[model samples]
Target: MAKEKPGDDKSPIAGTQSLDRALEMLITIAASPQPGMTLAACSAVLQHSKATTHRVLRTLVARDFLSYDDDLQVYSLGVANLRLGSEYLRRIDLRRVALPAMRELVAETRDTAHLATISGSDVIYIEVVDSPEPVRIFSRVGDAVPAFATAVGKAILAWTSADTLDERLPETLVARTANTITSRSLLIDNLALARERGFAVDNMENREGIRGCAAPIFDHNDTVIGAVSIAGPAAKVPEQNDSALGKSVVATAQAISALLGASPDAATALPR
Candidate 1:
């Protein structure tokens, strides 16, 4: 006889009714949009009794994993997701490797530079370097932006695992500026470019007057650990003007990856 796997659902619905109901409810809510599904809608989708669904959602909301909008009667993912992601970074060597390089990039361009990582449906800032120019990048450490909206965010999103991308980038984009790539096809094109050229650019995508560029950084396993970017005003980024700034961002990213024990064989030039 074949050995039974632990926690396997092969023995029929004899003992895990509550767990099954809860998981089904969670999955149903995750599959919905507009912050979340209405409690009635969730019960309908999961085919569970209203009482079971309510009990599960209430417990999850209490734990901070889900939010219930009584006004709209919808349920959605909550702050617990952010907290869990923050905890994941707490165990990693994010600062030891990314900070020094960010500072170096800031010095080179006299513009703000930052290191960011993909965390669920957002891009979380892990490190930041301020330019001496008084004007600076809008993001700070621990700040997050939609993955489809920012230059470094898009770079990391492009390199992320497909499942992760699916969970993160919405089927439709959230428009932050008139130039933002709200179309999924256009964002995919950008992703293709980032993968092909080893860097990414945002020409007023996140903010009306902002422009930025970024590059991916890999770990010892060749996994893209994060991305780094330099951001400034639009008037500064056109042509070779800010292109020079982009080169430095790419260089800083590569250097940090090296510190993380990565040995990239592709282009690896540090901007002068």
Candidate 2:
């Protein structure tokens, strides 16, 4: 006899085999490189008979989770999937989803990790994970800083639309510190670099003797919703270590984005 495969519904669970197969089918179709999957292609990928695959596909189509195109003989995700995704995104708490990763980032870097969102021309700190070291950066949860002078703000700004950027960015950027970029042209150049490197840095621009590295966080819709940042004294977060810390911040931001249902392609997409 042929050996039964995993998720074949022969185990202790009474009727999960069909459900497992259906979910797998949905994932396979969603991940397909083409716009949709032919019945034969679906069956081949699932390693199941055409009849069984057709039945599962029919059930999904009936439930509106998948759509079948007669002309193309293909199956693709339907409106129901979009509704489900929208509902899931509506209920997600950004700070709560990001706290664990922020904590982990602080542990690794020994610097304060902050979760912040854009509020007009300011960046508001919604959540913070403090460093464990004796002398570390301190930040209040509700503190707001100028979006033009901070790493987190620059990170988010790098991915914002041109129209939004024009609205958020002022005609004249006031210097918060001597290191802050006062020229609009220079700041724009800095944002461009941040977008290219996938992260941003503040070399004592936001506050004297403080430095930060940050990366933008994208949502399921590939929107720049917020940013994750690590900040500490300039002595500890030196320029040489910016690359390493930037990588950690980017990873943590990506993890939070995954939890928010962002697709793999979301990370690489630029502003619309």
Among these predictions, the greatest TM-score belongs to 2
Q: Per-residue lDDT of 1-272 in model 1, one digit per residue for the tens? A: 98977867544387878877766777677667667798788888888788878899999999888888878788998798779766764665967778878887878787788788888768888887777886565667889888788888877876776666678787678788888898878787888777777778888888888888898888766677678998888776664664577677778888888766566753332210
Q: How many pairs of residues collide in model 1?
A: 1
Compared with the true structure, all predictions reach lDDT values of 0.77, 0.92
- How close is every model to the real structure, measured as TM-score? 0.61, 0.89
Give the C-alpha lDDT of model 1: 0.77
Assess candidate 2 and give its TM-score to the true structure. 0.89
Weakest lDDT window of 10 consecutive positions for candidate 2: 7-16
Considering only N, C-alpha and C atoms within 3 Å, which residue pairs clash in candidate 2?
Answer: none
Of the candidates shown, which would achieve the greatest lDDT relative to the real structure? 2
